[model samples]
Target: MNELAFTSWTESTWVGFDTETTGVNPNEDLLVTASLVLLAEGVKGDLSQVETANWLADPGVEIPEVAAQVHGISTEQARAEGRPLGEVCGEVAERIVDLWRSGAILVGFNLAYDIRILEHSLEVCGLTSLEERAGGYGPMVDPLVWDRKLEPYRRGRRNLETLCGVYEVSLDDRFHQADVDALATLGVLAAMVALYPSVRTLGREELTDYTAAAHQAWAEQFNRYLASQGRDANVEEYWP
Candidate 1:
């Protein structure tokens, strides 16, 4: 493995990403939420200028109470303010694809969900898949996986909020919404990279590959923990 210095990554621009969904299955889940924030070097833009966006699209199904409780976007409100599902998903997919094409690294706390959902949305919109848009699936980063790999035995929750706290990054907005979550994810990612300078030298592809295996290991370990705690470990859902 390339033991690259992490400071080299500081020069790369990262697009912090997050999404809210009606459910967990990308193929069936409707994206009721989405956001992207640019995290460039030397200047962390105003949380306001972070280039954020959100949506409450009609899922064409009843909004589950548990999911609604997390995001507070209900079916009625979505119907009142939401655009057609195709339009909203298409717009989000196109915007991110354009960013990827422009060479910004896609960053997030748990980016797999966002990427998978975006790919599903693109398919639904008859646009190219995100993997295709990014030219053979590349240049993405996720701080959650980074943390797990860098400190496998460390304690405490691995959620974005928890990472923000560990990183001393402020959480200034609603937690589950896409906009704030994306920014928070970005902050956590920056802090992790700064803390682990070894990762700075990793090319985007290497970083993503490392994160993929680390995240899978984390999920397996977490499921065992949940089982020990007598909780139902829902494997199908993204570990949001």
Candidate 2:
């Protein structure tokens, strides 16, 4: 019989991406180091993640001390080892577009920040924006958003490390390294879908829409909380 078999989410190949940037603000930040992992599904239903590429960009400006403290890359180091900004940006853009063209979903922790910053980098380099290249940010799967949906009541700083603990996955590597974090994020996603197998049934588009909706609701509630405390917050109500 000719058949269309149902494959779980892990059956699909994923491009895991992460960046250690100059700052938290995507608009002002410059890429410091970035890594992309192409995770292929193994024959035994395991993952085989290969580090496809890594980049260090000469941002043409000093990386702030606060940011360096977080990612452990000093401005002096970047100047010594990083490539020209335009060249690095162009290469990264091409890589992302290639992934999209190949129909691989992008995965990361707090991925909207990374996507926005990458888009900003491309535009600043006078290359095509993400929208122009891939039609729009889509088919992205963020473990951060998924965790909030699966465990809404669990509280207190759900950073990448914390999520790893919740998923019972050990992140043995040093945190804040782009390559390590990207690989860890891929593990986290696999763990999530394994625990909540129903979620794995959703198609790529379905998952993206579901994540956007959840983020929108979360943003509304968080904005209201900020108003209660006389503060202003406008976190975007969507992810890549």
Candidate 3:
């Protein structure tokens, strides 16, 4: 099979994605909200050219207080205002698949977690997973993985807020809201590309492969560190 030709990062379309969930475990937690921001080529920062979608899911479970505090979505509010879990998951999955099929690269902060949570949500809702629908997860860009690999030595913390600070991306106090986070991820990516022009030169496939390998390398190193500390070393060595 001939591989599809891919444009450079600066010239490509990007779908910035994010999800706020009930908890951290993708396998068990439910998706409370999700956002997708589309940044078209040559108009990356222009609000008029950008397209956006946000979903609020009832999740069919009580929103934990801690999770509620993080994302500011309560179960009562969700029950009253959010759509059904299956309907929201199905629509989100379909939108993502359509964008991927149209050759838009997926962008996210820490994408693996969001992807896994969406995949699990689809399964729970009896809908097709994104992997199955999109054929594969690739042609994706994760700013978190890129930042860790690019600046491995200089880091106090690597969370989204910290990265936004490091990259000079403006993120207000509404950090955990899916839409805000997704947009911030896009800004951070732009900043990274500006600081590291070499990344913008790589083709889409090359960038995906590079980031995947970088993520696996980081996972392996971190797991070894955990083992050295006599803790369970269970970080999954995979990228979204």
lDDT of 1: 0.72
Residue by residue across 7-70, what tens digits does model 2's lDDT show?
A: 5445666778899998998887878888898887511134453656899998878999999999
Look at candidate 1 and tell me the lDDT of residue 164. Answer: 83
Candidate 3 collision pairs: none
What residue runs in model 3 are displaced by over 4 Å at the alpha carbon?
A: 1-7, 42-44, 47-49
Candidate 2 Cα misplacement greater than 4 A, ranges: 1-9, 42-49
Clashing pairs in 1: 5-200, 5-201, 6-197, 6-200
**By lDDT: ranked, best first:** 3, 2, 1
Summing lDDT over every window of 10 consecutive residues in candidate 1, give the lowest-scoring window. Answer: 1-10
Predicted model with the maximum TM-score:
3
Q: Which stretches in model 1 have alpha-carbon errors above 4 Å?
A: 1-8, 42-49, 122-127, 217-240
lDDT score for residue 231 of model 3? 100
- Give the range of the ten consecutive residues with the poorest summed lDDT in model 2: 1-10
Q: What TM-score number comes out for model 3? A: 0.92
- TM-score for each model: 0.82, 0.90, 0.92
RMSD of each: 4.3, 3.4, 4.4
The whole-model C-alpha lDDT of candidate 2 against the native structure comes to: 0.78
Pairs that collide in candidate 2 are none
TM-score of 1: 0.82
